[model samples]
Target chain A: MSTGGHKGATAAGRLSVLVGALSVPAFVGLWELIARSRIVNAVLFPPPSTVAVAVLDWIQSGQFFGDLSASLFRVTVGFLIGTAGGIMLGVLTGRFRLVSSLLSPLFHILRPIPPIAFVPIVILWFGLSETGKLFLVVWGVFFTVWLATHIGVQKVDRGLVRAALMLGTPRRQMLSEIILLGALPYIVVGLRTAVSISFYTLVAAELAGAFAGIVYRIEIAQQNMQTGQVMGGLAALGLLSFVADRSFAAIAERAVWWR
Target chain B: MVAMMHNPLRPTPPLRLVDAPPEPSSTAPEAIIRVENLSIVFDVPRGEVIAVDRVSLAVMPGEFVSLVGPSGCGKSTLLNAMAGLERPFEGEVIVAGKPMLAPRPDIGMVFQQPHLFPWKSVRRNIAHGPRALGKSKTEALRIADDLIEMIGLTKFASAYPHTLSGGMQQRVAIARALANQPRELLMDEPFGALDAQTRAVMQDNLLELRDRINATIVFVTHDIDEAILLSDRVLIMSAGPGRILRDLSVGLPRPRSSAILTDPAYLALKRDCLDLIRTEGRKAFEQMEAVT
Candidate 1:
């Protein structure tokens, strides 16, 4: 058994390494073929080397870091405010029939209006500044979170609610214990969706108005015909988005461990 | 009213059983919970559903009574109305001699599921009512600790609901109900979700705890054997739009056990209950089959 286990573990490790090695070679080989065959222009698609060098230069000069930090800050603040408000709204609407009737239709109507549509309006109201960026991010986050909360409330186990009532929970405790606990997994998922939207909306808002942002940098690169730099900036956004998503998922795994 | 008997549980002076009156209602301290011609109708998409018919029942200040019926027979609805969790279309639920309009302070209900708060520890879950109803933090903790010990979950007091087994979660729920020190306890199949071994253990624990607390109890169950073992009198209910069909005294000796189920008299009583319930249960099954 011990020998078999040892062989199995070593085989699994080798298989993972083999897969990783194959992926890199495959990607580079495809890129080389595309560039040499001229199926896509090297100037338009750019070689991976050129894109890597451009990203390295941007990072060394601290411009990429600054833009990344700014974007992160905006999304964080917007996410917190939107999630808090949306959760409050969700609980009230979910718990009370009257409240749901009063607020649900309004939210349903507003939720579908894309944050991009609000770009021009927000910029006009808050000015073409950080305030405008934040407005879009928060709006995107709010709708995602609100929807999750509503669904969460709807799906809570009726039996659990009955049990809490039997266990002598009063009105406020009943809400805090049963309603919020049941809604948590839904809220977490909602927050994750909102976080993704936050980044998407943040990029759009920045590209529309800002002089200093990841999106603005990409736009500048495109205007100057530096396809490599533009591709590098886009790659940076993708990597950052991947990292943010993983962090949220990691925290959520620990937070709602039961689910 | 079967026999006018005071709670033999209290530390009173020695008295003969013969000296006591026979009408149970007369000397039951005061009615801790009283239900008067309670009826309920639920608004469904198709039409109104008559969940309960005119049902009248009363629980003495410290006696234990079990309401037994087939599933969908509205025993749960009766208990819910008594707990002030549901509104009866007609009739009154009087708790501690006061008409219940909403969930009252002196009543606790245990639902079919544990309904424990996963976010909080077992101790904190038990403290929910006391903390909500204005008990100071220290006082609530103290009471919750006592309840945990009483419910035999002292070791799991600090454990979260997710960490505990189903039976343990249910135990936490019982402790939570007891923490408020309610005069009346309303339990709706508190052990239904437990396995057979755990269910029997829970029954013993509950009976032992009930003996100590001396609170008025209105327990609802589908199991006749359980009703016979735990209650002073077992109320057998009929099918849909349910009404009380029989109120038979549980003359089984105190500190009952699973072994009592094998006795001839217990079997006879069980057969009587089954005879009534089987007919009602069959009708309910036929009605359900018709729908589907």
Candidate 2:
């Protein structure tokens, strides 16, 4: 009797797995059928087949690579520069009273203002230039990484510091090794959050004005009323960001290596 | 290895005991660690509270001393003052004839928790002190290897602290402190966190380790057996506003082991310590009642 019940449960589990695997494909198949059935406007609500064709066309146009590289460059370079500045300043402000007193209030005040809100000022400063877009992304990523690093440094175990002091660790090595590694777990958490923030700010940046970028192409496709291309662009953006986040998570897991 | 077979993770065997050091003559005039009327104060919201109250003691070189007291008796604060980890509100702490304003490389301390760097392996953790003192990587690792062999953790030298048991981690911590080869070692209840069985083993291990090293040691613990078994002299301290109540010399024979616990002379010394602590504890209790 128990074996019968166990077999029944296993069958149910396998069925659920099968259904889950078909979920996305089933949704696409239904959409394709409905679009061809002429129940709704196919031009505006393009089917999966139309979307796929549009994506293929985009790849063939050679502009896809340009747009992808532009977008990738902005996010990577901006994230790197912003994260570096944030961690450096975070260590300074987090570790030293004088630096914290001088910068913390200003950072706290600015951090709450959304990166999107900087669009107008960014436009005024560097009209239609790549610098303006890069500025927006860096601005979005900087505060988050800075705040994380700052809090991480502050929350480092006081016992570890005391032990290091008793061990006669020099002031420089204390900060670079003991304090940095002690607070690394927290910093990695902050960096992961900034990865998403970088993408969020990228939207505002390209939409603000850009010659080439995935979001810029989305805006252009929208203007031309090519809904299939616009949907294709959206799909590409989602996949790119998802990959970035997952890869970052893997790196973070290794970052705290001891764990 | 034979005794530890019950636990597969514990590959360490009982270490071979080293010959005990020749007893230092009591008449040695110069003290290695001197606390002259030292007092340490902490500020609570209510007001200032004294932790160490005008305590004075002198430890001659190569002596093994224990500070015995109940919990919160400021024994650790007193030890910290000697280590230069705490500031004195009055009087002075002098080590090796130099006034201790800051922690010097010549003095080492082991806290209750191992506080090993989680990222570093046991070898690296032990090497940290020497590395911090500006020793090269190879030289530091050489020192760590020797200490690892001495502590009987050669199998787990590359293991991180988390992988090791409480006793093993504490052993690593001791080796780390000894890496710098300090002139004096201050330990604040180093084995207090271990289990009874592990604590016994650690106490025996420390006794053997002490026999080989020449550093003067000042250990703080609330365990009476631990104090009597380990110290050449035990200084008993009173509760709150901590003061040394009595100083009893442990006259047990050298090359001692847990076997000494049953000796009539050891029991007599322990009884005297218990009597002093019991009377002081009752007085402290009454004093609390009177204040309330």
Whose TM-score is greatest here?
A: 2
Clashing pairs in 1: A166-B109, A166-B110, B3-B22, B3-B23, B3-B24, B4-B23, B4-B24
Candidate 2 residue lDDT tens string, B165-222 = 9999999999989999988999999999999999999999999999888899999999
TM-score of each: 0.87, 0.92
- Could you tally the backbone clashes for each prediction? 7, 1
lDDT of 1 by residue, A1-259 (tens): 1335587877888888899889977997788678767788789888888888999999999898888888778888988888888888888888889999999999999999989998878877988888888888889999888889888987888876765665555677666658877888999999888879989898888888786778889999999999889989888888888898999999988877443
Off-target runs (Cα >4 Å) in candidate 1 are A1-13, A21-41, A123-127, A166-177, A257-259, B1-29, B282-292
User: On a 0 to 100 scale, what is the lDDT of residue B16 in model 1?
Assistant: 71
Question: Candidate 1 residues B6-53, lDDT tens each?
Answer: 445546545676665323233344566777667889999999988888
How accurate locally is residue B274 in candidate 2, as Cα lDDT from 0 to 100?
96
Which candidate wins on lDDT?
2
